[model samples]
Target: MARSQAQDVIRCQYCEDEPAVFHCVPCGDELCPRCKVFHLKSKVPSGHNIVRLSEKLHPTNQVKMCVVHSYKAYEACCEDCQVPVCIACIQEVHGKHTIGKLKDLYERQKAESEHELTKMKGQYKSEIIQRIKYFKNGEREIKTSHKNIREKMKKQAQDFIDHISAILTEALDESTRDEREKLMEISQYRAEAEIFEQNLEQLIEKFETLTESSHPADLILYRKQNPDTFKRFKFPFKINLTLPSYTIGHINKTQNEHQFGKFIRGHISHLTLWDDSLQAKYLTGFERVKPSTKKVSGRSLKISETKTQKGELYHVSCRDDRSAFVSGQGPGIQLIDRSGTELDKISTDWEPAGLAVMKDGSLIYSDYDNKIIYKVSLKKQKKIFINTDYGPTGLCCTKSGDILVCMHEILFSVVKYNSSGRKIQEFETDQNGRRLFHGPWSVCENINDDICLSDFSIFNRVVVLTKSGNFRFTYDGNVLKQKLKDRFNPRSLATDSLGHILIADNVNNAIHLISQDGDFLSYILTEDDGISLPHGISVDTNDNLWMVEENACVKVYQYLS
Candidate 1:
């Protein structure tokens, strides 16, 4: 502490009566004759610098030098070691640690300290003010409710006094719990806010001292501890308060009108403290990171009827776009547009049972009755794709322009075909050589190129396999104890845009949705969605779901939204 010569008179810090004669910078105080003698004789060290006020000199406080290498000033900070380091120390103990220049470190600490001070003074104060407003509103609500209850009690004073003790007791307990929770939240917020303000004040003071002096080494060490201090300080918890209505309590009808009834107090009914940073994130349209929890509920699948056709649709498949091709129980395959318009129909005597559509709008279907698979164009011309020894009941088109068909005779198996209708591979059993399927009725190809089959055997499960025909997992519907009371009889299978497998649970008259890895997600389409014995399931390019009922009725559903 140094006094300017322009100030003709300066009082002593301790006595405040006499003019200061000496300045003790380490103690940050000016002293008079008697106080200076006491300070020097008592606890003040002998080497402490004491300058005369009239000398126009700066007083020395403390000199910090590297202890390992004496008299050498610390030039940098070792962030990993959380200590100040001289030139020699950096080369030995902190050779691998991140080193920051003392000057740069000091500048960063000052900027951050200023930012913390501003946030606490401005944003935190505003948040606390908002909380006070909520509490005041809740108090007014309680008063209003009390007035209304008192008026009611005045009308039925004698009757209300009979059993009012029980009613008042229940209300008191409920109100105590609700109000206590809110009070605890507010108290915790106040405590945290106070701690934050205190820390900011200390940081600012430390920076101020460094700003007026050359203490870069001290700042460098302090800066290392402050980088992550405000990482979680973006949002303040909000307070929402509400007062519940109160009923009339015991009435002292025999007393004067002023004491007509004992008052029933209203408590805070809705009080919550929540962080608004998540909503703020949504406002920014965050698209880079995946959400921590997947949203799989709170959606409705709407059903709409397509154009009426003559025959019953057995199996359905959609192209790369919204157009769909349906195989019928009769001898025909019909093309339906996304909006339920019938575009074309090709009549065939083979009796198509399974269908799939390519990206080029070419239709491929299997006629199990004739043991023939046909590829038909939009022009109504057809070519024999494959003639399998086993009957092909389910068919699907792959991303690589290949075809996967489910065929069964005595034993169940799957077969893959290339674009030229040549059998590229056959998958009958799992990798462990165990029987993979009992009776697979429908097959689907997911976005990950994995195979999903809806088996209709006694087990009634969905068998899944990797792209290379490796065993994945089977969904038996046993996990759903509430939904599946009977055996899990699966009829049709399809994959949605979210990589969820949709299986038509024929026994439950609902569709079961599962993750791509075979974990049950949720039922996207159920009986509530107008599903009745859902036998065929398909998804178009627009992610719209198309399903066929057992009674020759077809329905399209808006499922994504």
Candidate 2:
């Protein structure tokens, strides 16, 4: 048995011809003396803990030697230094330090390491797996977002190309039509000239024959037969036809981008893991209030009328079921009830240009004289909301608590501000860089997040824009045709529950109801309906139309269910 065991000796892993004397723990390589030297000289890291093969095989019985005193075996562990120490090291270097038996310290450390391993295996490993899944989901979401963006961009490009092609085709067709008409006129003139020339040639040949043949009797006979032809020949008048000419429109890179639309870099959010709790919180859905499908009757039934002392009221904002805030060319804005009773009054140093009721039941008004916007709390306390560079004419509060202010005068723009008064966006021009508004009189937000405003300038149109500040369309009351008695003078617009824009045409003494897309739906109130000079308009929560006339007479009507 002893001879058989000796014959079963392991060979060197590096050199199979010789027996391995040492084992490298980190590299897991068994080597002979010569191979060991070569392995140490190779790219192996320093302090590999190479030990004798016998000690490696029986590691539990192996004695540890002190690092400082290599000749002596470790007997105690110095707690202060956190290292194993030999008898000589304890007496010399660790004389005043806390020490424990090496065997006891090893047992305690082994138990602690096992506990830590168990904890990691149970908790840390599961957490790492969950984190991996979260990151994978996030990667997929990012890929999907990028793909959608690419598709949207491609669609926009194709639409723009199609639009340009259509325009070009129309222009060519028009030019061809003009060319055909002019060519037909020229052909008619040529045909008339050819007939006249033939007649002249015939007459000349006859006269030449008569003169050359010395036949006075024949010439006299021919002249007597065609006496009417002897008169002066009549020539067709020249047609002064002008050819068509075209002037190419100059479109630079900036103008082209404006017309075709350019990319707008949106806000990018930070990346975070969507855990179960986060998913439960964010993935939940809520009910949305759908817009009404009822059509406008074009005839509103007058419900009640409240006459206010404020002369020529310019604005009226419904507060709730009972009261509304009204402002005019007065020193203060008054909140009045259905019975014409004053509920409250907010006195201002200057006349308020625009007034709106916020979601929190507070009143906000714009002072054009001071170029400032003030917010009045329910308790009648006033505070400065925002300072503007231009006079603010109209203002409204959105469902999200953001304020939309119409700044008029030299700069015509609608500026959006958050509750904290931070400017979020501004719409000054259309996609073609043309001015969007001449004088923005009143502003309102639709249920679809579209902005509707009345322009009180000579244009007298209602402009609509998307939430992202993109131009949608404009309504100029041309669709009304003969129905519109006077020029469309839009002022003080409001949106109904059906997302329809109702604009007051004070000059025509009518209210024009249009869709969110700027399509003229109907004239809800007209001169025939006894709505005289309707100016300030608003829609209450109950879908009731509240309008203030030029005489400061507030009228409520049931226009929609």
Candidate 3:
């Protein structure tokens, strides 16, 4: 590198020389500072931005080039070789190499790069817009799905407020009664005080009049004391009623007129759905799950699907499905047509919860809440025996007519009672240490004597146990995939004659269908007429469904098949 006091370092327009002069008036040659030509004619362009060879041009962003010669002006890149090339080297090296014009090459490439950057920026903008749309739409759908739940929660809160108000109202009434008693006592004392004050005032007024009298004859006559007039001056003690504090409603465990407690006229316990011979007749069983204990879910439930409503059913040394005893709510086991229409009502003091008519025609039932398993004779009444876990809610007569029960409360427990309600053997609760939540809501003994209980309250789980309380499988309305997590609360359980377990999905407001394994089947009612606050559910031998809503009517949905 070299420097000079003149412009054009590479060449001089007038002179062809190397180092003496940066430019020359005569044959000027672009020169470095060391190569300045002495006594050179000056032809400097005043407005030119070119730097002298003796000075650095402050590291110019404009590429270095010859100042006066337009042909030698700065250019960013060479197009033909696709590399940086200067004007002096062009003719020497790139003159015959298909060299592109420099200015044209730089302009063309700069525009192309700019276009690419614009295209990429547009693509990013479109992607951001699409992503926002995706998320917002998904959020709306999820919120809509729980629309009813929000309303339900608000209603529940209001109902809770009302319940608290009712408690306060009761307390306010009690306070009023107490205040009235005290007010009555004060009223009597105040009346006596008023009488004493009136006598003293009268005596003081008489002394004042006597002191002002001039003579005895001039003295005013004493007025008569009238007790009736004084009595009218009394006023009773009265005060505003006191307000009472609010109370939250809690479970009232005490016995009251609401028909709660053990005296029980009709309380639902073990309920089950069974399919008998006909599709028209399905069975729902109810059993006295516990004899001495007073709790629901202990009663066993079983119903026999009869073929025809043609005869009053009894253990007619029963042939096939012809004469089967049924567990029912109505007093007296009413003999019914296979359709459950009453043919003749048979009276029995025992409100049987679980009922099974044996092959040789011995009728078996769990007495009034899975308390005592019994053998009933339509011709005679008798208590066969006692057996079960806290009480049995489901009962099924085996091909051998031995009773299998799905127990309540304790986990993985189900007992089998012989025809005489005697505990032939006990199946202890020894499963995978998985005990049922709360007591069992309901239970079912499938034809195989495998037990299943609709268990779990806070944990809303349903479990199937073996005959000996071994955990075979379980479902808690939750799964890795969302599809299986919908139906969580099961109220009652039953197996159709086809061996499908029908579950009363109470919280889901539908019936859940499941295989004996943990596979979830479709729901029973998904549309409008399916269910509302479904509480207890059972299937008749005909595959018809009978369900109870909180305080709503017991609806019977008949499956035409």
Which predicted model would earn the best lDDT? 2
Residues 1-561 of candidate 2: C-alpha lDDT, one tens digit per residue: 999997899889987989988987656788899999988877742245567898685433345677887777665688888788877898898999999866567777889999978867876566667657745744654565567667867877899889989999999999999889878988889999999899989978888999898579998988888888746688867887676788988779997775554555433344343333222211101223433466576468888897887788888899986678888877798888777899888899988889898989888999897889999998888999898878998999998899999997677899999887777668998767999888998999987677888888888888888666667788888574788777888889998777778888988888888776677777778888777788788888888888888788988888874
Q: What's the lDDT for all of these models?
A: 0.73, 0.80, 0.51
Kindly report which residue stretches of model 1 are placed more than 4 angstroms away from their true locations once superposed: 1-297
Q: Per-prediction TM-score, please?
A: 0.50, 0.49, 0.36
- Residue range with the least summed lDDT across 10 consecutive positions in model 3: 310-319
Supply candidate 1's per-residue lDDT for 53.
71
Off by over 4 Å in 2: 1-295
How do these models rank on lDDT, best leading?
2, 1, 3
Candidate 2 Cα deviation (angstroms), residue 319: 0.6
Q: Candidate 1 lDDT, tens digit per residue, 274-329?
A: 35432211100112223233345567556567644556666778764556677666
Clashing pairs in 1: 1-25
Greater-lDDT candidate between 1 and 3 = 1
Q: What is the lDDT of residue 13 in candidate 3?
A: 36
